[model samples]
Target: MKPSAFEYHRPTTPEEAAELLAEFGDDAKVIAGGQSLMPMLNFRLAVFEHLIDIGRLTDLTGINHDSGSVAIGAITNQATVGRSALIRTSVPLLSRATPLIGHFPIRNRGTLGGSVAHADAAAEYPAVALTLDAEIETLSSAGRRTLPAAEFFIGMWTTALRDDEILTKVTFPIREGRSGFSIAEFSRRKGDFAMAGACVAVKVDNDLRVESCSIGLFGLGSMPIRATSAERSLVGCSIDELQVRDVAHAAVSGLESVPADLHGSAAYRVRVGATMVARALKSALEEATDD
Candidate 1:
């Protein structure tokens, strides 16, 4: 199947892209890499009257790190991210999770902003963004504004970005001190979307006691969710004394809606999700202790 007929506008600059979006309003959709959008369009799951192509906008493609965080330009592709030493060093979780997003061909054409903005519940980047509490930056003719990751994703395949707004950058705070991160998921194959998955970030003291931990669960909710209940339980416990399985249970305990489909039942997905959480937490703890 082919996408519905639409006008394509290839903007040379981010501002020009924003102007095109503003002009077309709800009828326009930005295409960068088009790895995700093209599939949806081909299936007719999504339709737009105008496709404002930002894939070639160099102004929206780069990686920069400051004192506190690293900001990645929206058009930066996943293949670049996977190879970037800065991303691997500054945001290890993201780098580690890169190959988990489909296969290399998809990653070669998939953009960071496109994935985050697509907001797929089972995607690794969204879960990592939530786990790291990254900041999402957007631009419009009106002005620019930033939003916390938690507030940025409001629903399935939906975000807080307005129709006329363009996502310009995503900033992830640097993890310093005793920190470790890991992501785990259960899929049919290496490139398949997880039936359930978890992204874990941990900060521990010298004695191997937990200082702070974040568990972001995906594929078990309407959006990627922070396992707050589970996190609260682990923050004060020693790794030796803590029950990894118990923490994983707590991670899925607070979930209200775990969608059941032909893929799996709600109970089955929650169980898989819990297992992934346990695997991720254990791996993260090992890394943290090694530090």
Candidate 2:
């Protein structure tokens, strides 16, 4: 099936995109990589009268790193992000998660902002953002605003972005100490959506005690679940098998509200989620110790 007829507007700048969104209101939909949106449009799941194409907006096309954080432009392709040396060194968690997003061809066209905006429960970018406490920046006719990842994702396929706002970039803090990052997901095929996944970022001190830790779970809830309870439990604990198991249990304990679907039962998802968390934590611990 093809998308219904719509008025297409190619905006060269983010300001122009914001104006188009404000002019069209709810009738306007922004298109970046169009990987997710095009599928929804083709399936008739989403219909809009106006399509604002921001694919050529040079303002939203690069990755910039500073002393404090790394800012990734909204329209930057996933492939570019995955291959970036800056991201690999500064925001390694994001770099590790990018390859797990989709196949090479899909990543070539999928945008980082598109994935975050789409808010797919099983998407890698959102989970990474949540784990890293990233900030999302948006532009609108009223001006600009930044939202933490925790507040940006409201629900499944939902976000705090206003109708007249266009997401311009995402900023992730650079971990300053010895840090390790790991991503683990259970997918039926290489490019398929995950049944359960975990993203772990951990910083350990000289004594191997956790200085800071962030855990984000995907494919287990309405949105990416930041396993804060589990993180708190491991903050001062030594990285070991026993501590990892306990942390995994704490993370899964928050899955009391996860809904079951055709892929797995609630019980199965919880189990898989816990196992993924354990694996991720162990891998992160190894990397942290090595670092």
Candidate 3:
């Protein structure tokens, strides 16, 4: 199916894009790589009167690192972020999770900000952002504001971004001391969305006890739900297989309401969720020790 008729505008600057969005209001849809939006358009799930293409906006296309965090431009492609040496060193979790998004071709065209803006519950980057407590920067004619990951994702295919607001950048805090990060997904195939998945970030103190940690799960809830119970379970515990599995089980307590789509039964998703969480935790622990 083809998308309905819409006026197309390619804005050279974010301000211009914002102006177009403001003019079109809810009838306008901002597209970057067109990886996600195009699919929705083709399916007729999204209808817009004005299509604003912002991929060519040079202002929104770079990766920068600061003393405390790394900020990636909204239009930065997945492959670029995945292959960046700075990103690899600053936030290894992103480097590790980008490939799990789709495939080489998709990664080449998919933009990080676009993915976050689209806010697919099962997407890897959103879970990573939640796990790392990343911040999303939004721009509008009014001004700009930064939103924490937890507040950014409102629901499935929905975000805190307003109609006139454009997500401009995503920033993640640099892991300070020894850290471990890993992702595990239950995809039917390499490029498919996960039936269930988990991303874990762990910081260990010199004593080898978990200083701080976060676990984000997809295919478990309406949005990427934080495994708070699991995080609490690991706070003082030494990293080990049994401990990880136990915490993973604890994480499933409040997620009993997961949707049962064509991917799998809710029960099967619970099982996969448990397994992915455990695997991600163990992998994160191993990486922490190696570091």
TM-score of each: 0.98, 0.97, 0.97
Candidate 1 lDDT over 200-244, as tens digits, reads 999999888999999999999888999887898898798899899
User: Which candidate would rank higher by lDDT, 2 or 3?
Assistant: 2
Order the candidates by TM-score, highest first — what do you get?
A: 1, 2, 3
lDDT of 3 at 243: 72
lDDT tens digits by residue: candidate 2, 1-291: 999999999987899899999999999999989999999999999999999999999989899987799999999999999999999999998999988888999999999999999999999999999999999999999999999999999898999999999999999999877888999999889999898999999999998889999999999988899988888888888665346777787898957558688878989989999999999999988888894
| Candidate 3 segments whose C-alpha is farther than 4 A from its true place | 240-242
Best by TM-score: 1
Q: Distance (Å) between predicted and true CA of 4, model 3?
A: 0.7
Better of 1 and 3 by lDDT: 1
Judge candidate 3 against the unseen true structure and give its global Cα lDDT, from 0 to 1: 0.89
Count of residue pairs whose backbone atoms collide, per candidate: 0, 0, 0
107: Cα error in model 1, Å: 0.2
Instruction: Name the TM-score of candidate 1.
Output: 0.98
Ranking of all candidate structures by their lDDT, best first: 1, 2, 3
